[model samples]
Target: LAIAHQYVTQGGLDYAREILESALGPRKAKEILEKVQQTIRTTGFNLLENVDPKQIVNFIQKEHPQTIALLLAHMEPKNAAPIVSALPQELQVDVATRIATMESISPETLDQVEEVLVSQIKSLFGGDVSEIGGVKAVAEMLNSVDRGAEKNILGNLERENPELATEIKNLMFVFEDVLLLDDRSMQRVLKEIDTKDLSMALKGASEELQEKFFRNMSSRAAEMIREDMEFMGPIRLKDVEEVQQRIVDVIRRLEEDGEIIISGRGGDEDIVV
Candidate 1:
C-alpha cells in the first residue's frame, strides 16, 4: 500500500496500478504493487537519510480497521494475511477498538469502488494487436522460448505495467506472419497486380515466386505481361508511388529476406553512378 501510494504520486495517477491489481491473483497483485512502486520510487534518486522503519510499521498497524482490511487485501492473502493475523496483541486490540467505534460505511462508496475497478481494468488491458513491434522483436524473443515462458512474462507485465507490453505487441510483425496475410489472401492480392510490372518488380526474385504471382493473376493479363516485359523501363517517381503501393508488403518481405535494395531520398552527391 505504501508503494502503491508512491506510484500514484510519481506517475500522476492514471489508475494503472489499481487496474493491475484487479488482474492479479490475490498474491501476485500484492507483489506487483510493491515491485512497481519500488521501481517508481527508486527511478530518480539515490539513498537518503533513512526514515524510521517503526513509523512505517506503525502507520500500517494503526490505520482504521476497514482501511487496513482493504489494504491487506491489496497484499497477497498468503504473506500479508499471516502478518496481519500475527500482529502484536496491543496493535490488534487497538485496531479492534477503533473498528468498534466507527460509523457504518455507505453502500454508495462500495458501488463506486466496484465501478472504478471494472472500468479501469478494461482500459488498462485494452490494446490493438495489429501494430506490435516490427516483426523482428517478437520473433527474436520467442526463438527457442516456450509458450509457458511467454505466458508468465505477459502475466507479470500485465500486472505491473500493461501499457508498455501492449505497445510492444502492436509494433512487431515477425516474418510474413498474418502481419502480411494468410497464404490464401496472398492469392487475392496477386490478382490485383499487372503481371509485367509484377514480374519486373520481381526481377532477381525467384522463379517459384514469379510463378506464384502469375498463377494468381488473371490469365489474359498474365499473357499480356509475358509479351510486354521489354517495354517496361525504369520506374517513374509518380509511378513508383502507384507501383510501390501495389507491392509494399511484398517489398517488406523481400527486404526482410535481404534479397533487394531500395534507395531512399538523398542529395545528388549521395547517389552512386
Candidate 2:
C-alpha cells in the first residue's frame, strides 16, 4: 500500500519497484535477485558462458509446473514476435501448428508467468528502444496492444533517433505495386535506376534500409546511380526533385510488387511508392 501510494504520488512505477526490490523479497525474490546480480558481477562481461543455465532451468523446475512450461515454450517469443513473426510463411505454418498442439494451459498460470516475462521483455526491448537511431529505428513505429503484437519492433528502437524517423518516412512502400508492370518490363525498368540516385537516396536513409534497397536493385543499376552521384553536380532541390521522381518511378515499375521511395525536393520530399 505504501509503495502504491508512493507511485501514485510520484507518478512512476520505477520508484515503486525499486523500493520493493530493496525492501521486500529478502528471503525469496530479493535474495534471488541479489545472487543473480552478484553472479553477473563475478563473471564480468564474459559471464554469459559461466552463468549456470540451470538458474533459468531450475526456476522452471522449482516454480509452479504450469508456469515453468509456459515460460519454456514462449521465452523470447514473449517480446520478440516481430522479428520472429515474419518467418517464411512455411515456417510460420509449421511453428504455429506445433504451438497450437500443446495442451491448454490455465489462464491464471499463464497470466502469472506473463506478468514477469512481460516485464523482462520490456526491459530488453527498452534497451533496444533507447540505443537505436536513424533508419534503423523502425520497430517502434508499429502499433501493438502488447509486445507480442508489435510489428515495427525495430521502430521502437528508433524513437531515440531523429534521422531514423526520417528514413522510415522514406521507405514506406506498399505490396500492391505488382500491377505496375509485367516481369520482363519490370526487369528493364529496374536497370534504369543508376547508382547515382541510390547514393542520393542513401544520403537520407539508414544503413540497413539503404542495404535493402541496394539488394533489391540490379547491380548495373546500382553502379549507374553511383556514377551519377559521382559525376552529378550540386544543384537546386527543384532539379534534384525532378530527377529523384523519375528515378523512383523507374524503381517502382521494376519492383512490380512493392513501392519505390523517392526523396523529393519539397519539405515532404519523402515519397512512398
Q: Which candidate wins on lDDT?
A: 1
TM-score of each: 0.25, 0.25
Task: Tally clashing residue pairs in candidate 1.
Answer: 13
Report, for every candidate in turn, its global Cα lDDT versus the true structure: 0.42, 0.39
lDDT per residue as tens, model 1, 143-164: 2223333344444455655664
Kindly provide the TM-score of model 2 when superposed on the true structure, using C-alpha atoms: 0.25
Off by over 4 Å in 1: 1-183, 191-199, 233-246, 249-273
Lowest-scoring 10 consecutive residues by lDDT in candidate 2? 123-132
Q: Give the per-residue lDDT of model 2 (tens digit) for 117-148.
A: 55533321111011112221222222111223
Candidate 1 has a TM-score of 0.25
